[model samples]
Target chain A: MSETPTLESLQAALDAQQAIFEMHQSMNMEVFYWWCTAIMFLIHAGFLAYEMGASRSKNALAAGIKNILALVVIIPTFYLFGWWIYNAFPGGFIPAEASAALPWSQSMGPDAKDLGTGVFWAAFALFGATTGSILSGAVIERIRVSAFLILTIVLGSGVWILGGAWGWHPDGWLLTKLGYHDVGASGVVHAIAGFFTLGVLLNLGARKGKFIDGVAQTISPHSLPMTLIGLMLIIVGFFGFLGGCIIFNGGDTGWTTIYGNPTNLSAFAFNTLMGFSGGIIGCYVATRDPFWTMSGGLVGIISVAAGLDLYDPGLAFIIATCMGVAAVYFAKLLENLGIDDAVGAVAVHGFTGVVAVILVGVFAAGTPNVNGLPPISFMGQLTSAGVMIALGFLPGYGLSLLLKKLNMLRVPEKCEELGIDEVEILAKPYPEAGVPAIAASDVPNKLANTELQGA
Target chain B: MGTSITTWENVSAYFTFADNPMALGLFVAGATVIVVGLIRSIIKHENEAFKQHK
Candidate 1:
């Protein structure tokens, strides 16, 4: 203090302060990621409500409970091993030398030292839950709760996580080798979920009375209001789900571009609203049905989700619109094939997700990689999308077939006819209606004299 | 012990005292409503069961 501080020393001190400031900024971003991940958990609630509403009254409670329970199983299992798989499998089948992010790993828990792991793990878990929800809708009324619960565990915790590890991770082999770029998991999440549902459907077969002599019958939802409410919630939750991925980058020189430039919330807001509007209009025009119209909203967002970060609002809207229309027709096509997807999960999630992956290539053709490599190309995007569909569908179908052979995939025909609620649950949701009341006089007469009862 | 309580306080403070408190509050309110809905559902179930028994 006595000597006037040298310019070099002052500069050094300023540099140190700047580094500390950057550290704090990074920590703030980590906090934001955690909050966003938590918000994404609402999507599960939305799915639960949506699927329950979509299911017949006989299977409503079962559908709701199954979707919720998938999370309970997925979270712990994923925590234990799922995180490791994501880091390990990015090279397709090969295991990488990356540090295994196991549940018991020191980095997993609340660590002031490393802030990224917790939020990232949570984000992946939300994706897993979404995958499970997609399967829950397809096999609602006919499937046993126990069997479906097991399926949820396998798909939510195991199969989907592995796929994410292989393809979704930036360092994943699919991305590194094939130049794959599914920015928001169109293929990794939705396509995989859809195919998995298809696999289960092949084994589970159609719900009783859904097919009569090789012809499909329509079973409409009991409550449209509930379904609409559920869809709205899903839309709201998706903002958090998709936005979380973008906001979580560790070093922000203040809202950097996907490739580290500079961005803002305004861009996301513009794209999301436009995409949603386009999807709604597209579905309405294509299907002329209110149900498909609502479903179009999901398709629209998912279709554009893979490239939303780079896309202009117009592009986002157009992609979303096209995706919505495609999802409706694809769903109809599946139904025509005598595949009874109770909630059209396969068509909406799988088909739209695959399309979105391809669209990303076209739309984000020249967008620079965050790692400063070449921009993602159309051919590269298609190849990656194809790989995901093949990987997801083949194993999923094979596993379902194996489960069917073991008599574990679907309930018996007798059980399906009696209703899964009556046979498996041992507790009817609507006990009064399910158990018809016998008059006291009639009951006594039946016991005393069979002939009197007949008369 | 002091540190733990302080950490909790810090977390809580981040939530309520953030910019765009209305949006944050609405999100929290939505969560609370879902929770309350679940509780109401359980209570209704119990009431229905009791009625059936009666």
Candidate 2:
């Protein structure tokens, strides 16, 4: 026979349970971020493959190395300053209260008192590295490795992090005052990188013999299949990149957007997939070329990214489809204007990113924001798009111009004529193909003098 | 005097950590790591969130 419990004893038991629950919640949070960082690496792998395949055989190895270096070099630099910018500037240029985010802070490293900080930094570092990779692809085959690394450091670790702080953070001015809502970072990540690449291209100029009599010439990929496969891998990596955008508040809070708006996983599932299909269809209908079709899938997702949290599935699909078509037109427009973006980075990322923000503003206007004082509106989104453009383009153009003036931006004309790999890398990409190493090999060995023969 | 809230349905089975101080510390440490991991996941994703059915 047992006696009835008193109220005080019940309270004691409940408190203990609450403590255990908090502990469990915190631990779950750490592990989730760790995996998010790990999966983000796949994005770099895909970019490496994609860029290398897009390049002439001689430049492939160098492209891969540049991507790898970006992945490795960003970790420390981001730790030193990039993560701090995210923590510091949510209020604007003036630093906010973020002692915990300081590089020397115990919480910034492995510390028993805090669990979330290190993983957060690592994941953010990956995000920063991604911005570098975007700029990396556009300038490949012509850029000096040293100059490229410096630009990568500035963009990946310096510039993009500022955009993130101002636009992506919870306490960001873009959100609190302007009612800016970019749940999927269409403006911050994609647009900023795209514009930055545009700036670099202005300085870097078109690849040699790419234009004759003010008309563009086609430069075919050595392995179209490899480029397409790499694009598919990038699509797979996007699943993880998208996963890192929301907060996993477990108990009373459930989940919320980075801006602290109501959301659920269902919205992501419907939109991301539908958007991909719509983009592919739109691209295929617009251009019969397989390469542009794959790019359309990426364009579609970005087009809908700004409103991913609230869009009806059908609307997302339709918006993505339109953007997919627009991406091709945008690319052609840039080409006509004499801008040589190697992978259509400007149209697919920069132009579509600007359009995506505007689309969401029109479609998602009057949508409630956190605290409801500000609501999503066209003007606010347009302003944010402008900011993203300036943030990306100004720094990109200025730094690249400086590099050019110093003669540190492009490789020597002779080296470029022979292939970057032959000047920089030592391995032969297609050793047995016998297709003439002078055009594509990494080394000036036996293959350099050899020529193709009848099959 | 207060009676225990140890109802038949509510009482949890004890883990060894509750009895050993060192083990309890380890439990908290492990929990910290896990929570940190989850926070990293939640914040980085352009996520699809699941609202637990209350």
Tens-digit lDDT string for candidate 1 (A1-455): 49788999899999999889878877888787777777777787788888878877766776777777677767766766677887777766777865637443445555555556777788788878788888888888766555666677678777777777766665666666656666567788888888888877877888878889877798887666778788888888888777664644544355643334345667667777887888888899998877778887888888877776678999899888887888888988987888999888888888988888898888777665666544678988888787767766776678777767866666566655555444444344445553456622211122455666646
In angstroms, the error of model 1 at A438 is 17
Q: What is the TM-score of each candidate against the true structure?
A: 0.80, 0.84
Model 1 stretches astray by more than 4 angstroms? A1-16, A250-264, A370-374, A426-455, B1-54
Docking class of 1: incorrect
Question: How do the candidates score on chain B by TM-score?
Answer: 0.55, 0.43
Q: Output candidate 1 Cα RMSD.
A: 10.8
Cα lDDT tens digits for candidate 2, A1-455 = 98798999999999999989988898888888778778888888888888999898988888888888787667767876788899899888899878766554435544444667777788789888888888988888888777787788888888888989988888788888888988887888889989999999999999887789999998877777877887888778777677777677767887788888878777887999998888888888999899889988889888998888989999999999988888999899988998888888888889988888888889998998877648899899999999999999999999999989987788777667767776656566777677675565434564545575332
Chain A vs. true chain A, TM-score per model, equals 0.88, 0.93
